[model samples]
Target: MHIFVKGAAIAFFSLAITACSSNPDDGFTGKESADVLYSDARTAMETGNFAKAARTLEQLDSRFPFGAYKDQVQLDLIYAYYKQDSTADALANIDKFLKLNPTHPDIDYVIYMRGLVNMQADSYFLHDLLNIDRTDRDPQNAQEAFKDFNRLLKSYPNSKYAPDAQKRMQFLKDRLASYSVKVAEYYIKIDAWSAAAVRGQTIVETFSDTPYVERALEIMVQAYGELGQNTLKQHALEVMKTNFPNNALVSQR
Candidate 1:
């Protein structure tokens, strides 16, 4: 009876091993070729199944690191991660691709996408839903995005992405200018006249093209006035009048 039980157990264990080996859930047993995997990934992406697409692409990458589809796979994976809201993963892959393929034909598009990703990295869904202003928050991500877009434009002036990147740079400029203005306002509120004046000066010089320059000049005027720097205050007032003659602050001065 004992011998029969052992034989039955051996038979069941062998069958279980065979079943596990052939399990469909075991992803990528090296059976599918790179082309087949690429096709599967493309179909998933086209169908808006980015999760599946990412998984399949990752498998393909591991299976065929130097395959003909390597570049396209990396690009698609970046987009998939972006769609999945996996910002860190997307950025990591972007950096990796850039490091390895600096002179690749599609480098311009990759840089443009990097800027887009950074632009939305710090977005607050609740703030958008409630129509709340986020200018007072830290603008680090916006700054990075601005630099990325700027690099793209400077490095590839005739790139197809330049026009869109220029537009995004404009938006980021306005946002960064607003953030500086907010900081100047905070310094003014706390009676930090020198700091406020410096911040306002930075805004005037760095963001002279933005609408916030007017507010920055006003802040500088007030801060210098509080510091008893009459000459500096007059200079700020003069610039404000020259640029924004109809501004109420200019009128008051």
Candidate 2:
């Protein structure tokens, strides 16, 4: 009887192991070739099925680390990650690709994509398209996008993406300067006149080309006036008038 029980237990254990090995939910064990996987991912992406594309690309990467389409796979992974709003993964994968293939012929495109990812991460769509200024926020992503765009322009002056990168870089700079102006305005509201004046002055010095310069100069005017700094106020007003003549702000003062 005991021998019969042991035999039955052994049979159950063996079947369990086999079942576990053959389980579909165990892990990724695709039998498809790398080319097929790549094609599927591409098709999914082209159809706006980004989630599936990201998953399939991830699996393809794992299945064929050194395949013929390895580099393109990495680039596609970045795009998939970006489309999925996975900014951390997108940036990380882009960095990985750059480190692995420093001399890649499409380095310009990679950098452009990097800038695009960061710009998207900035979440400035409303501000960029609608002109709805919301500058009282963090500018970390904008700063990163600015750096990436600037790097691309410097490295690939004649790149097809150069003009767009330059435009985006300018947008980021303007956004950052606008953020400083908002900070200054907040400081003014809290009666931190000195700090407000400093931010305003910094904007005028660093981002003179941005429209925020006008607002920043206005901040300086208000902040210095609050601090009873007549001379500095007059100086800022003169600068504002010189730069933005026919400005309603100067006329109001």
Candidate 3:
């Protein structure tokens, strides 16, 4: 009886050890350490394997949320998402970083990247491939990008990104002005003279420094004339003569 009991106890212990050793969850639970995972993620990024880098970084984030490299990992993840054209994810991460680390030394860079992501968010791949003019499409993304760049400049004027942000803002301003002009032209085509005049006036008031202002003035004159607002028409013509001296519209008037 004592020998049989001893054999049964040994068999039970062996079975327990086997079950523990063969558990899939145990293998999965033994994740790589934070340092090793971060190193691997960096290597993936350096190799331009952004997809792999993103996955690894996401895993590292989930496993070690408060690790020593937390801030840097978030920044790297943002870059990885941007490189992969995951605009929504990149923006979400950027917003989270900005909200959480408002005083981070690299906040200006984050803001600049936010602007860049928004700038490309609405870009049509096929349009670029075919050299198409899609400026007439909705400028919502461009407007958001413009606001972001403007915010960055206002908040961090001396940042390294300021110069590039300024250049992009100029581009956005011209694009916005052009979009307004297109809207004015469409209103005129539909014989909505009052609406066209309103759009033209908005362009003149808001985008006065843009090249589109000359066209906007022309639109104002045409729309006001069609609406029989002689005073407004003459006002637009006089402004055109003063600013655009040799404008074809002025000579026609």
Candidate 4:
């Protein structure tokens, strides 16, 4: 029975994909009416046939914009996309759902899923280490991922995902600060000392709470010295005295 059910799901998914990819102007009109499509799509989702559910939901959303099931279908479709790891599409539709039904009872689910997708995105280490030479690969994808998690933390501080979001946010904050230090190091090595100084200063000023503060201050000393601007260098030194008085590097200098 289980094997039969799986086989049926595979066949249903194949047909749904064909329906989604086929042009409306094609000769074969859809045999399943919108209501019937909705029923079948939901049945697919309940049975773990995510791809089939997504395809049918896509048809419902496009073909029945003004259909009575528009709102419900949109919500179900987002979940379908999420289950299929089409997270970008799921999130886009989530924004649409919020715009249409801001006061819906399940709004918290949207916020929770937003946090979940951000958490699922690739970590900074993979992007920073592996994509160093791949100019086509965006190094900023990590930043975008963290921003998404932070948004969830900020907006849904009390939601069920809040505790997990907060934990994820801290991890992001630490990694971002460390990555900034590496950028500063790169700039310092390439003789762009002032640029390096500013990047280090940003870590001190903006990410003062992060674990990277001491390292940034140490790098700032070298960056500012190489720039040969005593006045700006003095400012960087003062930041250490005021902000991180006990930072070991401060005394070493």
TM-score per prediction, in order, is 0.87, 0.81, 0.86, 0.65
> Taking the tens digit of each residue's C-alpha lDDT, what string does model 2 give over 64-165?
999998899899999898886789999999998899899999999999999999888988543444445567678888898999999999999999999999
On lDDT, who's better, 2 or 4? 2
The TM-score measured for candidate 3 stands at 0.86
Model 3 bad stretches (over 4 Å): 1-30
Estimate candidate 1's alpha-carbon lDDT, on a 0 to 1 scale.
0.89
Per-residue lDDT over 88-173 for candidate 3, one digit per residue giving the tens place of the 0 to 100 score = 99999999999999999999999999998898886765466445799999999899999999999999999999999999998898
Candidate 2 pairs with clashing backbones: none
Candidate 4 lDDT by residue in tens digits, 1-253: 7567666766776886785565442122577688888888889899998777777877777888889998888778877877766668877887788788878876766766655554444433333433343222333644665776677667766777678767776776776787788888888779888888898889888778898987888788887777777777777778778878887756776
- Residue runs of model 1 more than 4 Å from their true location after superposition: 1-30
Alpha-carbon local distance difference test for all models: 0.89, 0.86, 0.89, 0.72
Task: Name the best candidate (by TM-score).
Answer: 1
lDDT of each residue in 89-132, candidate 1, tens digit only: 89999999999999999999899989988887867654664457
Which sequence of candidate numbers ranks them by lDDT, best first? 1, 3, 2, 4
Clashing pairs in 4: none
TM-score: the better of candidates 1 and 2: 1
Error of 2 at 171 (Å): 1.9
**Positional deviation of 104 in candidate 3, in angstroms?**
1.2
